[model samples]
Target chain A: MTKTITLLLHRGPYESEYADLAVNFALKAREKGYNVNLWLYGDGVWTPHVKNEKDYPNVGEHLRKALKDGVNVKICSRCAEARDVVKDDIIEGIPMVGLFDFTDWLDNSDKVLTFMR
Target chain B: MKTLIEIFRNTPPGNACLILTKNVLSVVYGESFDDKIDEKMDITTKDFEVQLHPFPSKIAEENGIEGAPSIYINRKLKIYGVISPEEIKGLIEKAKPVKIGIIITKTPNANEDVENILAIGEEALKVGNQVELFLISDGVWVGKRGNTLTEKRLLNLINDGCKVKASRMHLKACGLNKEKLVDGVTISDEPYEDLVDLVMEQWGKVVIF
Candidate 1:
């Protein structure tokens, strides 16, 4: 069975090295045949919003590809509330859930990696 | 005691013992092997034993040891095993050649953190160095009870002769009850400042996790 790797993104995409490293790791893990899940927390909730802008390469596009390739993307509800992000504003394919749900996902995972900035 | 002797006695027949050498034979001899092994060996064998080993760095790379002054017994890292009390004693005897300091944050969230530090400290102590843990900030709450991870780890460290201290101001800020802290843990009125001074005063390398 493929191992599950949970990446906890705790910072906004642009401000921290965590997002880039996490995306890179997720893509690499997918290529390596591991099941990957990315949980966006704290400022990480802004990741899907900046996905497909004119100047931006669209992180959400990569996330979408990751999803298509079988990666699960989740954003924390508390973090979204703190950031004033509405559910409608969330990009399609990314689900927003509570911290407890995220913890359950982590507990069920084979490996958990936390990216804090 | 028999199991302890067998484990420490010059690497068993089928088991491969990887030894790391640093600062010449003196430091490695001082910290890596149990003192009982040294006491058991004849003077000629002791001299020969020290001379036979290569540099620690080379040995580490050759044996896939990740860090300096580490040992791998039975292809498993020694740190991951269920080490017995006797084995622990042997480790302490061998590890006294160096000095290591550990710092833990004393807070409600620090229970797990302190436990890990204690585990690492036990390993360090087994390697023969004096190990000291300084708890500061909210980390002083490591002494708080309710069967926390920190309490379990602290218990192990205490058994292994690791010194644990908590800061006074942090304790007051957290409103910690003095009786609730784990036994054998020293509570100081100025633990944080004392910890800082100790960090500055001693230890060649300081590891905080």
Candidate 2:
């Protein structure tokens, strides 16, 4: 049976390699026939707003690819607000949700991969 | 100073005992506590068939019983002083075989942490306990086929009966072939979530490395 996985991203894009690695894992999980859910919280909410700059792996572009590959992405609403990431400033497909939904996803998911700074 | 959990888990089930009341309560509340234990045991002891041996306080003291309501599971001392019925039941359940699930996400070069976890799993397997490993993230990088010392360690763990797996997506993303994984690693067709569920449902402990 297809198993569900939640990739919990808790780090920002710039300071560490956590966002790049987590996105890579999420993409890989999707390619492997797993239902992948990406929940952005804490500093991770900054990932969706990251612009592809010179000399760096474009985290936003990779997240877009993950979204295109059918990965379900959600951003923690409070975290997004705390980081000043309004709706239009974020990626198009990823929705802003609450921690309760994240908790619910945690309970129902078969696996959770956490990336922290 | 060992807690009941430590004593019960450290010793095998049938070979363990627990002594309660190594304090002034042994004199003041011993009789009442024993009576309560007897009453509770009548209804609750059916599942485990654990026998309770009661002796005169004099004989108990002779055996170095420092407390009241001493409990012996298989003949070894498991605890000392003050326990509830619910706690005893929990300890009994803990006496069974320990099931462990380990997830390795860091790379092999990341402080050699993967080797440590593999060693732990191997040790558990050597003692006839159950241990499983799931590799994800950069952890999948270790699945590459090679004769390196770390790879050999991983292969040794598999030879010792450890169930090793890697995330399918990680494998594909890293361009690793399932057929080429070091002699016994499986790239699960199911999602990473399922692997987590399988571990949590089947194992008694889950540790992420």
lDDT against the true structure, each candidate: 0.59, 0.67
Compared with the true structure, what per-residue lDDT tens digits does model 2 show for residues B1-209? Answer: 11122221112212123333212122223345453343212122213333333433444555554543455442233455457655655654554446678877777876768778778887777544678888876788777788374688888778877888887877887788877688888877664455545643566666666
Q: Under CAPRI classification, how is model 1 graded? A: incorrect
| Per-residue lDDT of model 2, residues A26-95, tens digit only | 8877876778899998999988886555575699999999999999999999988887899888778888
Docking class of 2: incorrect
- In model 2 chain A, the worst 10-residue window by lDDT is A48-57
Winning candidate number (TM-score): 2
Tens-digit lDDT track of model 1 for B24-140: 222334555453444323223342223222224454455554432233432223432234435544553543344567666435462465556667788777654568776665566
True contacts kept of each: 0.00, 0.00
Candidate 1 wrongly placed segments (more than 4 Å): B1-209
- Model 2: DockQ vs. true structure: 0.12
